[model samples]
Target: MSDEATGQDPAVEDRFETGPIRPPSEAGSYLLRLTRGCPWNRCRFCRTYKRRKFSLRTVEEIEADIDAMARIRDRLAPAGVAGGPRAAVRRGVVTNDYEWMVANALASGGRTAFLQDADSLVMKPDQVRRVLAHFRERFPEVERITTYARSRTVARLSVDDLRSYGEHGLNRIHIGMETGHDPLLELIKKGATAELHVKAGRKVKEAGLELSEYVIPGLGGREMSEGHALDSARVLNAIDPDFIRLRTLTLGPKIPLWEAFHGPEAVLTRQDDAEIAAEIRRFIEALEGIHSRVVSDHIMNLLGDVEGCLPDGKADLLARCDAFLDLPEGDRRLYQVARRAGLVNGPADLSDPGVRARAEAVLAEVVRTYGPGRIEEACRDMMLRFV
Candidate 1:
């Protein structure tokens, strides 16, 4: 009898289910989901997994999935074959999860994996350790593993727990710390206080784990822009995380925050591109005595060209920001139009006559369709797609 006919279970394959998103840096890493959704899904600006329910997978189930992944990895290994590349064609092995996993593993140099769902760090310390141990055992080649975390959750973990996590190979934690201004945090319903963010960041660093804090540039909008930048810098300077990533706010229509932003009594007034650039400039200026690397990895930022190590690269980053801010209004508008459309990456492109001409033509067309004043708003609307 076949294995299926004898009351024995058939061998499982492709049991893994990835969540909706992961960090841009994790594009080349294998996605392993230990949780189903965000445990605290109240952040107004975020829409990821909002429509889904949060549930943690049991240790047994997660181990089974890991075992399945290991089997696939071994089968997909690029080793000796009789007929070279043609052997794969003869075997009729079409690309699926196994093939994609192998491709990503090769792309990552066989060194990294990213745990998925919004807050995998919220898992119980013992449970997380088991998962980490299983990963290390199965994929001994992987050198780094990362996950998103909530500040309050990290703060709640005891020092011993965090230390064990590090020892078990939890190398990095990425936290979406939208803003450090308490009032804005409350307004945006971030659920965690600025003090909690500081504590959590310090805890991660103390455990010898690298921390990446995601900062939403226009999160506080116009009213709190100054305080947002200054206080954010203050908190970051206090903890000095390994990376400060730029994720400028783009008010998506589906998000609850959009209603608050568009309402007449709205407390938050969205900042235009130029205004946001100025705010980021102030934020960078306020950072002091920290060794964090500031990254403008997303296109929503008005100045994608701005990035460098703090203290050492401060002046250069500031100059890059000013390079865009000081441009002629028409030129700035053109750059903004091109940047959002994926036509240009940053300020460096403005120097190229071909890029300038293309952006100018696009801006002219936009101006014809909508008035001159609508250019910024139109670009903002396009930016929502990235969110």
Candidate 2:
């Protein structure tokens, strides 16, 4: 029936809450917001939720959202926008604004869900368990439920609390762990020490949770680059996380980390792309016998082909970085601009005539308009798009 006949407000729509940030792997999962913002917002390099205040959604409010999601899923099921309907579903009839989320989830088979905001594990253990239980009860098909967490918080939680979380179907945790060098961690005001990262990582792993620890390659800049690479490897070796994600540091004018780097009382000296790639290579070489997957998936990274598992694919990962570094200076510049502009994936793309032409054209334009000195700067600035 039309809004006029049913006396329903046509403009009113179901509200599905989502946080501002999530891991790259969670792109296809259902975004279930449990918190409003980052509780520890003092990380200088991160500006994800600077403008917003931190708060937790009450258990009642979160449950209301879960109920709303269930209703939306049900409404979209018959329409074949969710739950893998075999028949062709007519899409024109579902006019609600939130139906697109269901449609996207249906495309992926809807088996994973990511809890949102910077850290959802900061909630009370009983509260977290109840929310997880409610979520699993409502959607039994969701096989994996993951969330971002802080190392200090994880360290403080009792083993029983973490195990209970696992029992409630909380499958994974992604911790920043940006740098393991104490000075660098202190410089960034991460509010967690290297020891905390090791302890917390071990605790989570012991709880039978898959841990993804993110380490930033250029976080320590030029002065502490060596320590950043070696010490980070040391920490990762100690924890032996399931995933050792490489997030190459990218700074912008708005980021406090950048301001600090450029300030008179600078804490870090920024490194160029080549230097950062070399830093990554050093980190990879220093890694010893840890079974973790290294992912350089983001565009901000100078090399994209460096993903592989440790103790097995480590040599190939090293060769990928070396190959990029071995490229002729002129070709390297062309490839850097191409990668930053989203024009190519890796050096292999340069073999394609069409791809090479596009990259050369972009390189020529950058050199002509901005001058040779500005090419690197332009590429670095382009990274802001991904962030």
Candidate 3:
């Protein structure tokens, strides 16, 4: 039914906008589009904002979106005391996309919000402040607001500006420090140097904001894997971000990085699950003097259990990687197929009779489809689906 028929304002639905992606941790947060696309979308491995023009939404436009969200929240507020907004959605009372967005957030407790496009900090500090102020005014219940930012952009901002943003309710910043190795950074066209990453990360921490630094295992392929691991640890140790997220690399034909993996002049070679496991082990072993919690929250990762607080849990994190690495060839291949197929979480799951049987079944199917020697290739094919 139409908005008019449902007694809902059409303008409220029209003004709401969202971006393409958010961190896996922000699944429950209300996504607010502060920008249309990534300001710096040149990274070879990224296809998130490809072919899309980048533009910032004006403060007035952002306020309008917040106001629309507020209208939906008010409509759904009474529903929360009963069956909740999800029930209202099922009854067709929350029929529109905008209403559904608000409903999902309300269902998740409406305690967090994530600003979108890829680089929200690229906007003027004062403009971002205004948007945050309006959002807080509308949703004072929100406890946290986070956004993705480029190291180059964050480095450009002063500590005072970052602190001011924190004071205005933007509490967390997620930076994609894919690899701290300078050569790997240039090869990926990340548009930021190792120095810039450190500078930006330190500034965010210094400003009293929670920081999540994302690192991609196997980002350097086999050629620079060692440098990738050590340098990434070095950078993280210097910054000591609140979270160190592990997002293993998953490349396909759609991304520009795929070309680097093929051809006679190929400078990069893709790493299989086993190689990535070893690299992650090295990366974890090198981390020192930091208290960041390591997180492997993404499906792209081969080992979901390789997560823990640093310093104390460091050995445990390495042992998780070692457990996978220590497995025999057949067992490793079996676990890889099972993990990529979403049949198991880690190598430990294979010890369970039911899980082992399921994993064996998945391994047999993968070998049957792709041939025995091509198990890694089949796993890659499966991992690309998540990407």
How do the predictions measure up, each by TM-score?
Answer: 0.91, 0.93, 0.95
Show where candidate 2 strays beyond 4 Å.
1-13, 82-90
Q: Flag the better candidate by lDDT, 1 or 2.
A: 2
lDDT, candidate 2, equals 0.84
Model 2 weakest 10-residue run by lDDT: 1-10
lDDT of each: 0.83, 0.84, 0.89
lDDT string, candidate 2, 7-83, tens digits = 22223335667777678898777788889999999999998989999999888788777777777777766666543
TM-score of 2: 0.93
Candidate 3: where is the Cα deviation over 4 Å? 1-14, 81-88
Best by TM-score: 3
C-alpha displacement of 79 in model 1, angstroms?
Answer: 6.6
List of clashing residue pairs for candidate 1 = none
Rate residue 252 of model 1 by lDDT. 73
Clashing pairs in 3: none
Stretches of candidate 1 exceeding 4 Å from the true structure: 1-11, 79-94
lDDT of 3 by residue, 1-387 (tens): 123223455563445889878999998788998999988889999999898999988998889889988987898777662354456656776766677677777878889999999999999998999999999999999999999999999999999999999999999999999999999999999999889999999999999999999999988989999999999999999999999999989888888988888877689888888888999999999999999999999999999999999899988998999999999998999889899889888789999999889889888888788999899889889988888
- Error of model 2, residue 7, in angstroms: 20
Error of 3 at 122 (Å): 1.0
